[model samples]
Target: MTNTADHGRVRDSYDVVAQEYRDRIGGELAHKPVDRALLGAVVEAAAGGPVADLGCGPGHVAGWLTAHGAEVVGIDLSPAMVEIARREHPGAEFREGDLLRLPATDGEFAAAVALYSVIHLDPAELAPAFTELRRVLRPSGSLLVSFHIGTEVRRLDEWWGHEVDVDFHFLQPDVVAGLLTGAGFTVEARLEREPLPEEAETRRCYLLARRD
Candidate 1:
């Protein structure tokens, strides 16, 4: 189970920044070639079935997946974020959901993407988050997860200039890979890349895994 306080903090923080977050992130694909390519491959691997975008903020990623021919459903912890996602990507479905205890059925999706979404999860929630992800995927289903690569807890008192509370946890890639493996996922690929000059200084890690 997710800690209520922790979940509340994350929800409220994103709620406070929902519109600003959408304005800034909704068009990020225009500048992020690598992310676009990775998401493209993920959609291809999904093979035309439904894909879940966990922690989908404004639904840009889900929108991209929809354009690529895969059905997409975006889930976020904040209702405000889900609202923005629904408005921004009318073709795709959006709903409020917790990563550690997703409001989804077992084997409900053929693939799932958690792009930079796990950054908001505290250390203790990581294991259960991945477990819930695996539970929602069919056998041999794909999972594409990305996160900042480090060992730091970045606390924000405000976002988009709005007062709020949130903690962004940077985790080691190997540690996350191990967590996925222990959760019954077969780690297929891992990539680490230096941040683009216009982006944050922190390195990013992407892992592609499959439910065994």
Candidate 2:
């Protein structure tokens, strides 16, 4: 499911294209109303405690949380991405860390968000990542996860004219819910939406849950 090879590939791929990716996607929320609304709700549920934005690419979402009155820390697998995040959001904490083995102790965060962060993982690896997410949150802490909805792993050979190795795994919403349930999370809401004009055509899903 999760191998060091794939993880290294992901980190290296992102490192190679961090700047272009940041320039392209940093303003994405401005055109995504649904995402902004859901993220606002997540911040509110977090209630001012430290929130972990797992796989927080470039720290845009973490910046949004900070703008909305939440204390946030952004984590990513790519050091280049983390550097960009730190430059973009000086007020928020940014660190390089893996989702399967976060650099935090148990019950370290009050809430967590993983927006399309698990897309690189195979289905078998998702449980371990979810368990790691649970391990970092306090009891009853909230979690908001989003992902592409479908059954496909889009293997991207090149991005922005740069060669890269990455696979994006799209999952069914119900399957994701089952994964959360098995990881000791209580599913509170399931949301799905069609993509915007600037986005991929695939449907997107959001799941709000709480640690049990």
Candidate 3:
């Protein structure tokens, strides 16, 4: 899908599901201890720099970033989510924006993150998304992405019996790393973890990369 159309569809989906998304998604499971650990490790490795929480639904990750002392901005395609994020996390900044078309300038970010966000984009579309990510990042900028570790497209299905049409294109770790490399990001660390019982899936990964 073209970026414009893809973004529009994403906005529509999120907006259509906003209330249910917020009500049904998230918890100790959604925001897990492992996330804290991963963030701690990344922050320590960050050496103090700003981070952009791309596709940051309801600003949960942005809240975590603020608590951890990282300058952060949470951007999402849905204005409703942004509003909720701002209302819930009063101090944090939440913007209505598309990840594939960032409003940030080049070298403005020290790091970019998409926690369980990129799965919405298929592999063919990843290069451009990664390219857009590369555009806003400073040279050697850190990129951390997390997603369900799997093969094949997890098509629109009844997620928790909601019957919502959500598209997920899961990739093996190697393919993700390759996309980062292809986008001029050097892989710093790549990890796979078994999901907690409460999670939708038992396997996910964190890929830490540096723009070259």
Per-candidate TM vs. native? 0.98, 0.98, 0.89
Q: Is candidate 2 or candidate 3 better by lDDT?
A: 2
lDDT of 2 by residue, 1-212 (tens): 36879988899999999999999999999998998998888888888889999999999999999999989999999999999999999889998899999988899999999999999887888999999999999999999999999998898889999999998999999989999999999999988899899998989999999999
Angstrom error of the Cα, residue 11, model 1: value is 0.2
Candidate 3 lDDT by residue in tens digits, 105-140: 788888878888888875678888898999988887
**Residue 127 local lDDT, model 1:** 90
Candidate 1 lDDT over 1-212, as tens digits, reads: 75889889999999999999888778888888988888888888889889999999989999999988989999999999999889878999998999988888999999999999999888888998899999999999999999998899999997768999899999998899999999999999998899886777999999999999
lDDT of 1 at 12: 90
The Cα RMSD in angstroms, rounded to one decimal, for candidate 2 relative to the true structure is 1.0
Question: Which predicted model would earn the best lDDT?
Answer: 2
Model 1: lDDT of residue 37: 85
TM-score of model 2 (CA atoms)? 0.98
lDDT of each: 0.91, 0.92, 0.78
What is the clash count of model 3? 1
